[model samples]
Target: MSTTPDPTYHRPVMLAECLAALQLRPDGRYVDVTFGGGGHSAAILEQLGPDGHLYAFDQDADAEQQAQQLIRGPRGDRFTFIRANFSQLHDELGRRGALGLDGLLADLGVSSHQFDTPERGFSTRFDGPLDMRMNSEHGPSAADVVAQYSEAELHRIFGMYGEVTNARTLARTLAQARNARTIHTIADLKQAIQSCVPRGKENKYLAQVFQALRLEVNEEMEVLQALLTQSAQVLRPGGRLVVMSYHSLEDRLVKNYIGQGKFFGEAEKDLFGNVQRPFESVTRKPVTATEAELAQNNRARSAKLRVAERSSLMLS
Candidate 1:
């Protein structure tokens, strides 16, 4: 809103690359589906003409506050912030009679502000409540997952989401530990599974454990899949889908959806054997932050960006 981003908010990762991928048209309509700190949303607003409109979405209340601040600022007239998850993109837009967007951008992974806030419990670096809810107001917190999930449920999430090596041991340890004491905070969870963590890789091990809990609590994968499926439906022909994912799991889903039009399996073919795909990859490989960006923003280190363009051919 002030034309200057809050220093504590997320710094846009690979900003230049993402803007270039969008190929912004002055009068085009675009959506920034993960408006963490309004970094990308503000940038998109800059590219839009007075006739252009930008819709930003976020489930986080903190982000909604930031968006409200932006909407009261200089370019407010051209921007609208939807306080909802991107998974509801279609319905939200349709309700406003706004569909067929020219482009959509999603920068995935936890925001810097979320991770840095000790109370949010996203980072292992801090000792705080094991909350980790992006929206914060709804859904089960990470503490709930750690305290209530069965050994098998914990094992499944840790193994599948975090890809932790000793997930089984960690899950068993947590189930046993929680019975003795409530795993209500980061410190409690860490102490509970300290014995299961690989000694030399404590940081990485704890990160994986936390990641599993965070993903399960938020249903991140399911939400992401929903957003992708809706993107194919709401984007106009030749519209761009620019997504930046932080982990391999998200990147794999983005890659498969763009290349195959499905999260799994091969692309379906028509009677003539022509593949029926909704979008075509603009980037054959996921782009990463340049050394210059990485030097300035350590958070960009794990970011993987992919771009796709909606197919011009109509589906039967």
Candidate 2:
């Protein structure tokens, strides 16, 4: 039987900050939505006494298995692992009869495992197949998008998500290349991108392309919207919704959701003077990693943590 190692093995991003934002209550219920390496879950468990219960959710089967091993230890009974995406949090919590959560956490973006593993296709450093599905069992691979999307659509994805300077030119290049032959591997894709863009800073250019592809492959923006909506609903009044986003696109969405219930804009008040908005922004500005943390973990540099508390507003 494999042994459950210490939480250090996973290296939870901004661990101290997340715990502080959570503000754990010994007797209150808590949820860790992205139980990637169980680092956050283990930390939350440590804070919980005998009566406190922690429910965790992770779509990846491997994450579930690791969580199972951790839960089987001394603190086993208090831990519950769910094999599902955080977007369906409301329904899943309802089915489990959970309510009035003390705190909820979502560590968004890709995990270390995805980037470290070559076949996952998240990193530009690896020369693997262009498969970037978070859940390999479902959804279209990154290659599918490159092979199928129209030039205009590809340009939009690269420009919007990756912030590529020459997205239009790159998109046209990709379209022409695909017409001639298929792009099967990361090396092939990188070479195609290099042909369009100059040789200087190749890694930066390739990274942006990969970012655009991964974001589209995972449908990250759509999934984030659903998860954030569910998080607001599932959290009880005054319950904290702590989210750590790695990219500006996601951080912007989180900021808007916290300040105003919708992404379009904050709701305007009528002459009747009725208030609107489901959550109150706890952090007006997103919190970033400390210099110390950034020095230790380069990944923390891109991490931005935004917190919100549930309000009395009822869904219409």
Candidate 3:
């Protein structure tokens, strides 16, 4: 709605690079799957012709409210807000005749607003309820995972999702502690696992633990796989898939999907040994924020962007 981005809401990370990757056409249809603050959605609407449409998807109520504000703007008719997760991309788009998209952009990771809000429980710096569900209304909270998950399940997610070095020990410690007292808030969890945190490295260790719990609570990896798989079906030949990931796990999946058409192992091959793939890599490597951008936005430091183009060759 407004040209100026709301710093309090979210500052679009690597905006220039994302737009360039999209290669926007005035009459082309586009989708911004993670419309946190409507910043990027507004920018896309500005570049679109009257006939071009932009569909934005976000399950967060706050984001839905922001989309409503954008819908009341002059470019309202060209914009559609779908209050659903990107995992439902294909079905939602198909219903609106948005299939064969010109391009799709997904800036992955929690938004700045979510991270800064204490009640959202995304940040370790704040003391709040351990509720990290992106949709909030659906699924078990992080507290549920901490209190009910077995030691083995906790170990698996911590080591696999968080990449925590001392995951086994941390899981065992948490299992024992939860038996004695409730772990309902950020402060409570921190105190419960105080002995497990390495001295002088408490912040980093706490962050990893929280990240693991948040990932599990939201089923982020599975949802991301869904988005990547459906992206191929929604985009037309030569349509772009531009994704920005904040952490290594997400980046790895995006990279592998673009290069191999599958998240794990190698690409499938046809009878002639020509590799069957849905997309070809547009960016040989993940792009990082320039020093200029990093100087202005500290959060941009961890952002990594990758782009790919939908392949014309048919695949089973």
As a TM-score, model 1 comes out at: 0.97
lDDT of 3 by residue, 163-243 (tens): 999999999999999999999999999988898899999888888998899889999999999999999999999999999
Question: Which should have the higher TM-score, number 1 or number 2?
Answer: 1
Off by over 4 Å in 2: 1-9, 270-275
- Choose the strongest candidate by lDDT: 3
In the range 1-316, model 2's lDDT, one tens digit per residue, is: 5435345436689899999998898887999999988888888888898889999998876687789776777887888999888888889998988867889999998778778889878898888998998888788899999999999999999999999999999999999998988998888888777776657877777778888998898888998999888887788899999999998899989887777677766565557865477888888888899999889888888999998888977775
lDDT of 3: 0.92
Model 3 — which ten-residue stretch has the worst lDDT? Answer: 1-10
* lDDT (Cα atoms) of all candidates against the true structure: 0.90, 0.85, 0.92
For each candidate, what TM-score against the reference? 0.97, 0.94, 0.97
Error of 1 at 219 (Å): 0.4
Count of backbone clashes, every candidate in sequence: 0, 0, 0
